[model samples]
Target: MESNEPLYVIPERYRKIENLHIVFWLLKDLCWVMLWRPLGLVMIVPTIGAAALITWQTRHIKSELLHNIAVFFWIIANAYWMITEFFTTDDSLRYYAVIPFSIGIVAIAYYYIGLRFAIKK
Candidate 1:
């Protein structure tokens, strides 16, 4: 059977959904970076290390569910640090909060790009 057809046609609904997803992801990243950048640089090492560990583990586990679980914990840790910093007026609390927030940013990126793509596939 030989068929002649339109080469490129996207359904309106799918296009809208995809566009919304892209916008949401971008907004999420922007918020995280804006809110966390100061702390992010300070904790870069651990953030990178955690991400590397997640990437290596995902290869062996091959489970989206597990990856999602890791991502959840990463987000929580980050949020906790942020909350702690916001509530505490003490100067000493500043340094301790950076690690969690930085790692959280890395985890957010990983999930937004990697895990989300994997699940879609």
Candidate 2:
């Protein structure tokens, strides 16, 4: 049995960008893990750019928009945490990552607690 709900398919171009986004995200994390500071710093631009682009592209879809926005924040938090580690051995500054992390969480929470209900109604 199939319910009557339209399927959501990302445009091929969008999907391509999304795939590339994954590559950039992974490369950024890899560079961070390997302690390649320069490359990791460079990777942030493309990684965050792709995330922002995805969020913009999905703005019309509330769920996708919220999730993509969360992804954007998640990358920011990750990059910031990476930078903190790269710059200092101490974890003192790592707490700053909480800001972006919380933003990401709020975005998801809003989607689940607010937008999800609004959409169903």
Candidate 3:
């Protein structure tokens, strides 16, 4: 981490516990996606790597970090829904994914807006 960055540190022992929470949530979403969408297999490895990142970044950081993590999973879940719908019903449910995806985008905007304008210098 940069020495001058606004960093938060978690207790060393709690890190493992916090990471477990991240893994459980990430794997749950990924497995659900994998069950319905074959294309999800392509992301298995990358998702695990990303889960680690989510865990690390979210451990002791502000709520904004958790918001970002939620955004990622929301997008992943939407992609899974879209991919499965594409393979199963020929794009019949593709439009339904717009809801969660839109929500994810909004969450991202909020997170950034908070970071840029809400925090004091």
Candidate number with greatest lDDT: 2
On the 0 to 100 scale, the lDDT of residue 67 in model 3 is 72
Give the backbone clash total of model 2: 0
Candidate 2: which stretches are off by over 4 Å?
1-5
lDDT of 2 by residue, 26-68 (tens): 9999999998999999999999999999999999988899999
Query: Across residues 2-114, which tens digit of lDDT does each residue of candidate 3 receive?
Result: 58776666667656655664665566466555573443555444554555466466756656465756556575655567466546766656667667667666766766776
Clashing pairs in 2: none
TM for every model, in the order presented, reads 0.31, 0.92, 0.45
Residues 1-121, candidate 1, lDDT per residue (tens digit)?
Answer: 6679755544575455445534543444454557664454344344434444444534544353345445545544554454455456675765665565556566566777878798999
Give each model's whole-structure lDDT: 0.52, 0.95, 0.59
